[model samples]
Target chain A: MSDEKKLAIIATKGTLDWGYPPFILASTAAALGYETQVFFTFYGLQLVRKKLDLKVSPLGNPGMPMPMGMDKWFPVLGTALPGMESVMSSMMKKKMRDKGVASLQELRDLCFEAEVKMIACQMTVDLFDFNPADFVDGLEFGGAATFFEFAGESDICLFI
Target chain B: MAAFDQELDATGLNCPLPILRAKKTLSGMEAGQVLRIVATDPGSVKDFEAFSKQTGNELLESGEEAGKFVFLLKKA
Candidate 1:
């Protein structure tokens, strides 16, 4: 492996839980003094949105865990509940807070300060009707070729 | 012999932050420099462990004091 490394993170999910992985890894890589970039596509672009992407709640996923024990294991009952995703999302947020993990916003800010590159997928942006101005400052626009070109030189590539 | 002396006070900061700061600090140092970090976040222990593994930095000593965690790192 090269002593100096580059990393590319592909973000495709918009949920709070899903969002943490990419930010966490990307920030960590930047902290390690590696050249890092996070490419947001599809729903993942929500994170770059100035307001709509902040604090996403999993409101509709039924596979989320129940409040108490045992009920989580029941087969069909688990799938029938509403707001299960919200519960899971809250649980994840709580766990992170309790464990002293940085907030999503803090991680993002740290990444920017550390000069980690952030990119948005142009096709997804157009499809979602997202204005480039709606995203955080310093977001670049590109597609798969852009991502591949960046990833090809990196020692590590992660899709989250 | 002292390689180099650096201190990072990450008290009240969280997991990745401590490790993050440690990484940034180490990056500017030459091999064999020593870094001392004090943190209040509990997850820092595990975070540093993983950091040492991933970055090849050596954790010379780590322990708890006055409800705070302290780590001595040797850049490798």
Candidate 2:
């Protein structure tokens, strides 16, 4: 791939753990002067929604660090217990906030300030019964063709 | 602390935040200006290296002092 300083990110997951990568990378790419676009598809539609404020599911996400003092087999512990995902999600958010890491909403706002193009998948939005008003302004709506048009011109295409 | 045209205290921020702040700070600076950024994230060492390489900015020096990572970047 050539060093064209452009990045196309395909965001297909909506969990808090998965949410950070696309927004984080997109904002970072814009900061580094890259033309950045993040296309949210499939289950990723939740992120574009206004203030759904999704949580992390420790049962399925292995990358999330075990909450302080929790066992390494936290997922197993979560499996043994119900509503553990909310607990895990809160602890993770607290840890991240205390560590000075920007929150998901903060990162998303930063992306908007950076002028990174955000696209919502048309099929997913239609399937989910979400209208353009359900999302914030300055977003483009299109299907796979829109994403493909962006990916075709970029030097780096990341699927996260 | 070093002599720099601009200084960004990215202390306490992790990973991409430090880099993003540094990039924002450097964007307003003129070419050849040196920026000193203090970051607490351990990953910033390699991240800055790659960022400089990709963006054509110059990394004049980088080191850990007093438990914080310090980076000197010149706007390219």
- Among the numbered candidates, top DockQ falls to 2
Residue ranges of candidate 2 with Cα displaced over 4 Å? A1-3, A60-65, A68-82
Model 1 misses residue B68 by how many Å?
4.6
Error of 2 at A13 (Å): 0.9
The whole-model lDDT of each prediction reads 0.80, 0.86
* Per-candidate alpha-carbon RMSD to the true structure: 4.3, 2.7
Fnat for model 2 comes to 0.84
Against the true two-chain complex, what DockQ does each candidate achieve?
A: 0.55, 0.77
Name the 10 consecutive residues with the lowest summed lDDT in model 2 chain B.
B1-10
Which residue pairs of candidate 1 clash?
Answer: none
Off by over 4 Å in 1: A1-3, A55-95, B1-6, B11-13, B24-33, B40-43, B49-58, B66-68, B74-76
Model 2 CA lDDT for position B47: 96
lDDT per residue (tens digit) for residues A1-160 in model 1: 3667899999999877677788888888877768999999998998777764344443454554445563456555554457755656677778777777787888888788788899999999899787888899998999999999989999899888
Cα miss at B76, model 2 (Å)?
2.0
Pairs with steric clashes in candidate 2: none
Per-residue lDDT of model 2, residues B3-74, tens digit only: 789999999998789988888888899999999998999999999999998888999999999999999999
